[model samples]
Target: MTPSARDVSGKPQGVRGFSGALWHVATRAPAELFSALEELPPLVVQVLHNRGHAGVECIREFFNEPVLPHDPFLMRDMDKAVSRISQAVRDGERVCIYGDYDVDGISATAMLIETAILLGIDVCSYIPDRVDEGYGLNTEAVEKIVKDGVTLIITADCGTTADEEVALAADAGIDVIVTDHHHADAVPSRATAVLNPNSPDSDYPFTGLSGVGVAYKFVQALAEEYPEKLPYPETFLDLVALGTIADVVPLRDENRGFVIDGLEVLRQGHRAGLRAIGAVAQRPIETVTSSDIGFGIAPRLNAAGRIAHAQLALDLLREESASQAEQQANELDALNTERRQLTEDAVSVARQEVGDDPVVVSVSEKFAPGVVGLAASRLSEEFGVPAFVGTLIDGVVRGSARSPEGFHLAQFLGRHAELFETWGGHARAAGFTLQPVNLPKLRAALVEESRALEGDVFLGPQLHADGRVFPGTISFETFQYLDQLAPWGEGHDQPRLVVENVCVQTARLVGANHLLLTFREVAADIRAIWFQSGQHQADMNPGVRVDVAFRLDLNVYRGETRLQMVVDDVRPSAGERSLKE
Candidate 1:
């Protein structure tokens, strides 16, 4: 049966997607909005409307370069952080930049340390081992830093909520400037200066800065504080862009500006680490896009923390020597391959335990804490439920949880605070430590809690289209026009289009479980790729009529630029379905 929805463009849209998904097509905008943006293509206008940039001025401003980075002093304690760090620089006090293990943390750490060293401050970086020390500022790590005689600690991407650890450092005569972007439930009263835009005390205009983005702000404030000595702060946007995009923050406001500008710096090949990383990943550093960082380089950098020591990744980022950077980048690339295998194995084992539960909770000694998050995320996407995967080590469990929509992971974990040793994360993802015995209780609790859900969550597995496309309408030129809304990420996704009732020219299995497809068009055949969908080739053979949802992209292969359609979903056309029935 064809489920229909009346579109704003006065057409009937097929709303039911293949494999039980819901497809939403944005066919038009409000009359006033449409009239206001009549000069632009209707597809772009529809996309702009869906993204809530309906205002004419707002749309124009977006097309233009994003405004300059905001004033850093506007943050809650920018002055305090600058003054203390400047003092540390002047006095030659030993300082450390404590960072997390992920790409966001590693890149933020590198940026902050580079800034500090450039300012003539005696600084060293300390990123905790993901498997050994866990995340953030631990008391043991703080004590170790104290033993190193460090007097000041600048935390990058972490330490906002390390109240007790901050107190411990404060007791040992070390001051901590927590420069993080995570939500602060209660600002650490003991931190010398907390510089999170999301902090309760912050009046920073934008709250979406990533860990490295916050570090950029810190350095920007420092540049304003010391105009003469510090080198150009904009030089670090390469790192900022890498971290900001990798962290998956909304690519709006300052984040968008950073990526747009940083892509230039990253492409300049100034950073030896990124260049080497791009080479190892088979992505050209000179023309890297936000998409490149998210899929290509960032995962390799993150693999260091996931499979081994994060220090190696940090060393690569800070490496100035091309040879060393290449060696380290290659090492990270190998680790990424290993991490992929580990995650696949963990997910395979975890999948068997899912059964028919509304929520997935599985704990095993075989699950490594490093890749549990990936496994949990995979299971959540596959099963459309909250998944909690834990590594059972020595009677305790270090676990990661992932949820799709309509469930707040952090809030749910918070409700069961009594069962966990430590827990914290945002709405959709979280981590916790608890006794192994608590697994069954948490599982039962999650299932019970899921029963009360309104069930709208199950209605999803939804696909959103900016507009519709006919077989002959989408071209490379069309992609170029819509791409003016460039640097798409978390909140701003690349526009998708629905092409209904197109004839398949060919569908063949290509590299490693991917479907290489082509559709008949007026001027030329449209080449398409449906990655990981080789299993569907039988049904998508030549001459099959189908409705396909896809996004346009320009694939640069061996110096040739070709317009390619990345298929999102496909289903038999109404006529074909009727014929089969």
Candidate 2:
């Protein structure tokens, strides 16, 4: 799907950028280390530290310039889950793999199916209908699985909260193994083994594994037990990377390894689905990155779930033939276009209905069930408030929600559980359902709860200087230092450089949403684009003196590669102390 640009806060140029630095400051990075690192160039060290690679060995291990994988058993439930799945395969019992409707769920499902198939188990895969089945396991879906001759079920990204559905499956004599990464309210019953990092009993080395990461651990454990039965499990890193990046999981620890190595596999273009998606999205397949997956690929995969059956995304990933993969890619792309239009219309309606309150709670009887979450998220971004965008499906009102910082959306929604038929999620995102008539109360309850919180709960955006770099500091040689710190996202992110006293030689709107600028500081000349900031051109005049946060990039045009800075934000220097100092 073609990506639509949205206005985001300033992009930072140094130390994993502002968010990364904020995490460090919040976590208490040593002053000496922060100061010393700042001198080295804020952007590079920030990214390095954000990835938990603070020194030489850490950096080497991070890039996998040297290879490493900590004990597989460190992952929660690795050994026990593996043993059970292996025993199930040996018993020749039919197994069904169920997953959620997003990119994480789809990739995890595909990973499980492929791994099981290699182990001589043709596990049946089930993805609940986004519009019809809602999120997670349902009693009807489980009963259907039981009737389909399945005895064991491996659930990816879901089933952690389906205590009742799992119990129902157990009553029918089916064993369930849940491999999910979603945060759960309490221990669930009926699963033979529940492998979730967030579970209280889990000692998983990382709590931030995406659904695909959890699925990969299951395969990793399987490979440990029967090395000869299946190929090394690392072959699926491409899928892991796609789902990991798409889901916006923290890119630290094992997650960093998964994405770092997975990006290389994706660059190899082994998956026809990724290749076809790159073609349809007009991205170069050979140079894919986390950004490409997040911005370019995931949306199209998600579009399938939002507008139609999520099975289409799973099918594209699981296609055995190149031709079939291409066909599915095209179909998903077309659906995504329609999905975008639907989301745009839904958001437009949501905006009109939402008032100028600190929180936004809106309901649209006409909103598409599939795209409500996207609409909610978009609305949250637009208004800088928590949002719940709901639609009536059948007799119940089902919806998705997006929350801002300090909102704890899932917990807040959970507090009002009496009003909901069912609900699930984490701090930033959540889902719920209720009788249609109950929405007004639900909306009022949420808004009232939101208003009770202190104002200014969110720390307004700020710029973190990586260190000062004169225009002269920018060169192909200097850029090599920047290039080593790559494969950035989620827990870690691209570096942001704070360049001060830059003269805005020129500025103008370019393309649909980007602001093109000609900038220079003493000894440096640069070209930059403030994407989605074109509307600010009126305020940012040529010859203006400003401090800017940006990333250095290369734009190849007419076969000539030239250096460019991707400006994230610009501020008048008179406001305060020099941010770049």
Candidate 3:
């Protein structure tokens, strides 16, 4: 899990530039063994082997549809959470589902609401305003729910760290069943029934369940108790995939099965709400992929949380009417665009202030609370360091921190817990708050922590090329074979193909910074383009021999399709095959 971009001035030998070659025969055996291995396709073997699948069985499982998940009752506290919620429903207690503002939170809320509805229970959702009310359950929101006669609260995606608020709700006679996936605290005495896979007391096999994953499990538990209330329990996997991918959970274990099977349901284009969202996002549901969920659908769903309230996304998910859902979806799309702009602007400003620090820490009183996480992630990307983006909210300084590969944000914050009012998050990303006066102490502590660590603060990027291949091996057939590995997400990435000592028959600039190249392989001639490669074009021109690292992709224009090599990196070759100028 190396950070992709960093200065590679004195990098160790053998590492390729994002697509560098590995496992060469010269470094292993003779040409006979190398040829034997090459016969198997290097790129395919490299990718498959990198992901711990060497045999045909593993490869088949990797590509094929995953198996069904075990029963929800397999979870530790599913029964307790479900029993409490069912009791509330039977007692006619007004229940409010409090959820987070992100896609995970929204989907979790929607899942709970739908499950409750199936049982003929009256359940409403409440998502805090990102700008005004901030994150998690708050006193104001609790008072309002209590006033509305809601005596039971089912929290989704949040409330793990809301110890005080959960106590307040209990004082007001509202019992809380927190069905969350966030990391558990040490004390762990907040909610009445805390059903989190990450909890220390839990024995769930896979702890990377998204917020929606926990919600689905809770609903499944209820479905078990009241079998007549719902049909088969696995029908809501489409929502599962949406939130799972949106939250960037590792697509492994139960999560892999959830998304792999869930994607089939999403692609069917049956759900009115999803259909409407697909329409607004302008993606054909029949052609939906994992990439579509992350790039097209999730952002719009998350937009409501960033700009206003996550309830909008929850409502859109639960909407029964096609027209109304479509309208809401369109609004979400607009809000997503606004969110993108805001995040980009914040990232630009934050990057300028990061300087050359190994650990980036910056604060902005004006940054939107919803977009800070994204901004911190982008800053981490640009600077190759863990980043913290903070904003002053209602006398409390709250922010999101995104960490690079080697850095553990949660552990780092935990070491400095005395400075924070509340702090909890995953290894890669986290959220926290402290007094505005404590900001300087936290920043100083982070710097000291990074300085005390040995060696590079950044993890060196390791480019695992799928396999080595001659330039002639790259063709339409090859591209199609590689594209078979679709629906790529976390735990699986697109394969990289490498070509060695190819003569740049011709090269020129196309659109602005794009570089188009006509290259000559041993027996094949092909045209390739590198997007945003003005500097590379100036460095290498016609007749220069070079090694090109790129990924295979299909390009379509006016319905005509052709295979293209998306250049990742190019370096001058020292071989004797240079074409004379």
Best-matching candidate per TM-score: 1
Look at candidate 1 and tell me the lDDT of residue 240.
92
lDDT by residue (213-289, candidate 3, tens digit) is 98888877777788888776678888888889999988777787788778898888767778888878866577777
Give the C-alpha miss distance for residue 388 in model 1, angstroms.
Answer: 1.9
Judging by TM-score, tell me the better candidate of 1 and 2: 1
Per-residue CA lDDT of model 1 for 1-581, tens digit only, reads: 11111244655565555544566677566767657867776677777777888688887776764467899999988899999987997899999999999999998999888888778888888999877888899999998999998999999999987999999999999999998988747878988899999887778999989999998899999998888866589998999999999988988889989999999999999878889999998888987988899999998999999889899989998889999899999899999999988998999998788676688888888887789999998888767688999897667899899997789987888788899988877778788899977888998999888877845455235667877666666777678777888888988999888777788888888899999888876235458989878878888878888988888898878888888889888877878877978
Q: Candidate 3: deviation at residue 346, Å?
A: 1.6
lDDT of 3 at 366: 79
RMSD of each: 3.1, 6.1, 5.4
* lDDT, candidate 2, 310-362, per-residue tens: 99999888776888888899998999899988998999888788664666777
TM-score of each candidate structure, all chains considered together: 0.95, 0.85, 0.85
Ranking by lDDT: 1, 2, 3
| Root-mean-square deviation of Cα positions for candidate 1 versus the true structure, in angstroms | 3.1
lDDT of 3: 0.74
Find the 10 residues in a row with the least total lDDT in model 1: 1-10
- Estimate the TM-score for candidate 2: 0.85
TM-score of 3: 0.85
Q: What are the runs in model 1 whose C-alpha is more than 4 Å off?
A: 1-20, 522-525, 579-581
